[model samples]
Target: METMLITGANRGLGLEWVRQLDAAGWRVHATYRDPAKAEGLFAIAKKSHGRVVPHQLDVTDFTAIDRLSVTLKDEAIDVLNNNAGILPARKKFGQTDYDEWARIMRNNLFSYMKMAEAFVEQIARSRRKMILCMTSGLSSLSAAGSRGTASKFGDGKHVYRTTKCAVNMLAINLAGYLAERGVIALSVTPGWANTEMGRADLDPGYSPDDLVDPVKSVEGMRRIIATATIEDSGRLMRWDGSTLPF
Candidate 1:
């Protein structure tokens, strides 16, 4: 069975991914900032028997990441999904909170690099080397300016958008570096899903069944990660399984 590691598994999209992947017979190493707060996940793991294991990880901590790396050193991780991210509560550009901005960048972008860097050797050992970075459509310069649907989230949070934009470049650069080694590093937008940070009235017109529910989205992402080939590396993809503009 293929093994995978997911961050922010306590709630929202991360928890759903754990459920779907566990059901599919994948060995899931799901991390939460505090395992004590992951009651919901613990309940789900009870049902999964032993396929899922809860991990305590604060992605910003390099020491913790390195420690986890050593613990799972023997396991070959097929996919590393950097799904944990933060949305700014306030949206004014000049009125930004430096601490909040720093936190978002740490969790959304920097931690991804740290995790991949620390675990690259483990991923390299896997038969199918894949890394999935979850991104937002709001992060796209084209989508942000074109008024092509993603513009609904008005500007002001320069910090959040900038961090995601950085993630795009990070994926591209990493893909280039890993290309020769047969590793696939790709960025994907999960569409406008109804997560805790999303607004109430903003709907993508996708049905509840069709919408990017966290559980369904993870399954879709797993399939995409599984099918990745040299030809598909370095591309930006959507949850609908199509390439998106950088």
Candidate 2:
């Protein structure tokens, strides 16, 4: 069976990916931070009949990551889906929170690199050797300016955008290193999906109605992953398999 290890499977697009992949008969090692925040994930696991296994993971915790790596040491992780991230509050040019900015960078950017460093051997041993980073269109120099309406989103989220951009670069850099091991490491933007983080109050954006379906976006991403080859690595791609600029 094709297997995947996806972090941040508690809610939003992360939760959606868990549901879709579990339905498609893929074995999923789904991780979430808080059990209290994971009711939906636990419910899905209950119905998954052993196909979906849930692990408690805080990607920002390197010690926790190492422990999980030891726990799953013998298991083959085909895809390491780095999907855990935090949504930033609106911050104007002068209002950037340096502390919070650093926190987001650790959560969104460094954790991905740490996960790869820990689980790369498992990925190398898998049948479909791949590592997928969940990036954003905001990471792109050419694409960010055109993504969402400025009126709704305003000029904020500098930290979130910066982390995504850095993670994209990290994924590309890993591709170069892992290529010798036959691993395809690529980053993909899940688009502006109608998830909790993608809605108003999070960043004062549109309602769920204005965003793309999370399920549909994940479905497209699955297709992209299933067909991805080494040639596709080191590129920033959309859920629809289109390229995004760095």
Candidate 3:
């Protein structure tokens, strides 16, 4: 059976992906920070008959990541989905919060790199051999260049955007390093899924129907993942299988 390791599987896109992949007969290692809070995931695990196992993990915890890596060392992981990340309140230009920036960078960027490094061995041994970092279209430098404010300075969410932008570059760098091992490394946007963060990304004028359904979003991303190759690596991809600029 295909094996998957996905972080932040307690809710939103991560949970949705876990649901879909588990139902499709995948042997999934779904990681979440808190077990008590992951009632949904726990319930899925209960009914999945050992296919959907939820593991405790905090993406920012390097030791925990290494521990989990060792635990799953014997298993060949087909897909390692770096889906855990944080999005906090932003500060204005001159009032930027350095601590907040550091915290988010740890979660969104450093943790992604750490996860890939920890699990690359198992991934290299798998059939699919993909490292998927869940990112956002809001991080697109190209979109920022073309749209947003009248100043053309880009949209806000300062700390979140910078970390995501940096993570996109990190994926490209990983692609080059892992290509020799037949690994495919890339970042992807889930489109405007109807999650808290997804809704937050939209403008105030948008409505409930404006957001992409999480099921459709994950399904499309899964299809893209199934077909991704080394040639498709190093590029940021939309859920619809199209590439986006850094």
List the candidate 3 regions with Cα displacement exceeding 4 Å.
145-154
Q: What is the C-alpha lDDT of each candidate?
A: 0.79, 0.88, 0.88
Q: Model 3, poorest ten-residue lDDT window?
A: 145-154
Model 3, span 118-177: residue lDDT tens: 999999999999999988776788686222352133345778888888989999999999
**Candidate 3 to truth, TM:** 0.95
Winner on TM-score between 1 and 3 is 3
lDDT of 2: 0.88
lDDT tens string, model 2, 17-123? 99998888999999998999999999999999998999999999999999999998998888999999887887888888999999999999999999999998889
**TM-score, every prediction:** 0.89, 0.94, 0.95
Displacement of the residue 34 alpha carbon in candidate 3, Å? 1.4
Query: Can you write out model 1's per-residue Cα lDDT over 1-246, one digit (the tens) per residue?
Result: 888888988888888888788878988889999867899888887887778888899999989999999999998988888888887664664677888888889989999899889888888898888888888776787656323553545556577778988998898888998888777898887765656654432435533443356655666776787677878877888776877787
